[model samples]
Target: MNNIVEAKGLVKSYGDFKALNDIDLTIPSGAISGLIGPNGAGKTTALKSLIGLCDVEGELQVAGRDPRTSRHKLMEDVCFIADVGM
Candidate 1:
């Protein structure tokens, strides 16, 4: 199956604090997945990057378009709602 979301060497930082580093992930089409981790594990940062709500380094593609440049296009085909972590 083709990947619906892809990230390689993904990195996100806030000033000098690095939240994510070299995170590689792939999600196949029509697959159910979840990001599970403790707090401060960069789950939120990774999600933000995937949804194009945060700028990130490295390669990222959602729906075959780069989230940084084609966020509008991506959003046209995607929707995300962020809620407090349970």
Candidate 2:
């Protein structure tokens, strides 16, 4: 199955602390996936990175588009649970 979200070698750091390291993720369309780990395990960081909430390093894409460069375009097809939707 093709993936709606994909990340390769995803890395996020705060100063000297590394929140995400060498992370690889793939979430296919119409599939439910969960991120699980101990506290400060980078789940939030990864999710934010994918949704273009924050800038991080490494290759990341959403729906076959680059989130870093095409965030607005990608967001059009994405929905956040907490946001008002129509």
**Residue-wise lDDT of candidate 1 within 40-69, one digit each (tens)?**
899999998997888999999999999899
Which predicted model would earn the best lDDT?
A: 1
TM-score for each of the candidates: 0.91, 0.88
- Backbone Cα, N, C clashes tallied per candidate: 0, 0
lDDT of each: 0.90, 0.85
- Which stretches of model 1 miss by more than 4 angstroms? none
How far in Å is the alpha carbon of 54 misplaced in model 1? 0.7
lDDT of 2 by residue, 1-86 (tens): 88998899988899999999998888999998888899898878888888788788888989998888999998899975532331
Q: Please give the range of 10 consecutive residues that has the lowest summed lDDT in model 1.
A: 77-86
